[model samples]
Target: MDTFVWRDDYSVGYTPIDEQHQELFKRINAFGNALWEGQGKELLAAHLRFLADYVVSHFQTEEGLMTTHKFPLYEVHKPVHDAFVQEVSSVLNRIADAGLDTATAILVFEKSCDWTRAHVRGMDQELGRFLGAQRNSTAA
Candidate 1:
């Protein structure tokens, strides 16, 4: 029901991660728009699958960067990614079973978008700060 828009406050201050986050938002918003338009079930499913694949790929990149940087909260942060994967899987299953009704699909899509925004703002932002501090400390 509520339209999601990217805002300056969402940036985590790390360029790569911020870019990925933006892409994620863009993809999710596209999916949401398709649903809002009362698209056909097949089209909705395709968009949902695209979003799921993108999330997995992006999460891998983010996780790998955190591991390489030895982010202090990596352990805590990774479960968020894992949970997202599981949630997406569950939604896919529901769509398969119930055939992607517009209202239900829109609700699930919004939930996915909310989770991503929260994770980026909370966990990713903290990781960005940690990484930035580590880089600055090493430089000095």
Candidate 2:
């Protein structure tokens, strides 16, 4: 499996979020490497656990930024986060139920890659623009 690489264009224009995004890419890549190497189920489980934990922590960081900045789209934005959490949680649950088989691992990897790209490009970019505009106005 080819690991997902973090491109410069994917940045959300915030240091913390960008850093977390990079970390996510690294984690996903590690997960892929483990899958390719046919590592033990425990190793795969560790990566999945990291993904589960990151989803919670990273969402909180993003949502807290939205709340603090009084971003008008907070309500709408949160449901997107919620839905993603649900999706990831579902995959985690599937792993628990079915074990870290090939299909399950592939499902987790594909879903993570897809969601990360779409969310960052769509919702997060909008947030970044709003934040940039806010900073500019405050500076002026």
User: What's the lDDT for all of these models?
Assistant: 0.84, 0.83
Clashing pairs in 2: none
lDDT score for residue 21 of model 2? 86
Tens digit of per-residue lDDT, candidate 1, span 15-123: 8888888888888888888887888888888888898899999989988989898887889989978987998888898787556778778777878877877888899
lDDT tens per residue, model 2, 32-55: 888889877767877888877987
TM-scores for every candidate against the unseen true structure: 0.91, 0.91
CA RMSD of all predictions: 1.9, 1.7
> Alpha-carbon error at 60 in model 1, in Å?
0.5
Off by over 4 Å in 1: none
Which regions of candidate 2 are displaced past 4 Å?
none
